[model samples]
Target: MAKHYIDTQSLGRGPQRLAGQARVADLSRLVSDLPAQGDLVVDWSVAGRADSAGRNFVLVQAQGSVVLQCQRCMKPFEWPLDISNEVEVVATEAELELDDDDVEGPDRIFCEGRLDALGLVEDELILSVPYVPRHEVCPGNQPDAAPEDEPPAKRESPFAVLGSLKKP
Candidate 1:
């Protein structure tokens, strides 16, 4: 499907809702961080709302699965993406700065009239990705497994050598 851009101010005023499916390939920011192979599926929904303080906010929900290279085994693994967030829309950087100290509240986003729904989805997906992706149990051979031809190494303790030198 073609990309969609919404007027942030109008959407916030009406508190509109948007839902769609976007190919993972189309999300450049998300695709760059993932492994080259495999198909990914992304489903997303966004809604506009006004808080009690009359601040414009955007609610986003994005779910999908992408193949990631496991850091442990260096192999591809399927990782699910589920992101749900509500961001207060601010007109200027100063507004965001004012809200920065309010860490306990929802995040704040600065919108310059137009908001890119696809880019928002991509950002959410990227945030959902783990710092290090790995399976609970590796799908292939254990990474630390020793070669079959190599015998396990044995070491003599320093204390044993000292004891031998001080034999009674």
Candidate 2:
């Protein structure tokens, strides 16, 4: 059976609630706070998988919508995030190794005691953010004006030339 811990010590080997799925709105206090302080509402209806190696790995599968602003249109919209991630929870880099997919790697989050699902979710969402997030199209977007340096030139096509040659 899996065991839950509130400290860095590793408990007996078994299945636990390491990975979770939840619907959250604000993550300001969750991620910024070091010990990962926030409430992560796990949806028991949605099944998730969690694997650990000496308290180093925690994989979570989450699916929910996050409200974000469209970088192009400057309008807020809800973007659904289908979360399937493996986050490593560890203390030092020396103890990290790439043994399993969910094994917390060298560049992983380290916790003192309790697992902060809220902070983990926030990090995942931020990483998933697109560099250029925009809707299909917005009304505010307009065609760019031609540069002043470039001069316009008129050219007649073959069809136009043939029409000109025709009498009438």
- Give the CA lDDT, 0 to 100, for residue 71 in model 2: 72
Q: Clashes per prediction?
A: 0, 3
Report the C-alpha lDDT of model 1 over 1-168, residue by residue, as the tens digit: 576676777753577788898878777777786777356678999888766677888888998888889888898888888889988888898888884677799888889787887787778888888988898888765568779999987888868877868857
Off by over 4 Å in 2: 1-8, 18-23, 29-55, 96-107, 139-168
Which has the greatest lDDT? 1
Residue 49, candidate 2: Cα error in Å is 9.1
Q: For model 2, what is the alpha-carbon lDDT of residue 26?
A: 42
Q: What is the lDDT of candidate 1?
A: 0.80
Model 1, TM vs. native: 0.78
lDDT at residue 98 of model 2 (Cα atoms): 46
lDDT of 2 at 123: 66
**Candidate 2 lDDT over residue span 1-168, tens digit each:** 132333333433443564444435345532232222234343312112234435555565556655556778777665556666765566665545445475344346666557655556566666765656677766567667778998765666758767768877
The worst-scoring run of ten residues by lDDT in candidate 1 lies at: 4-13
TM-score of 2: 0.51
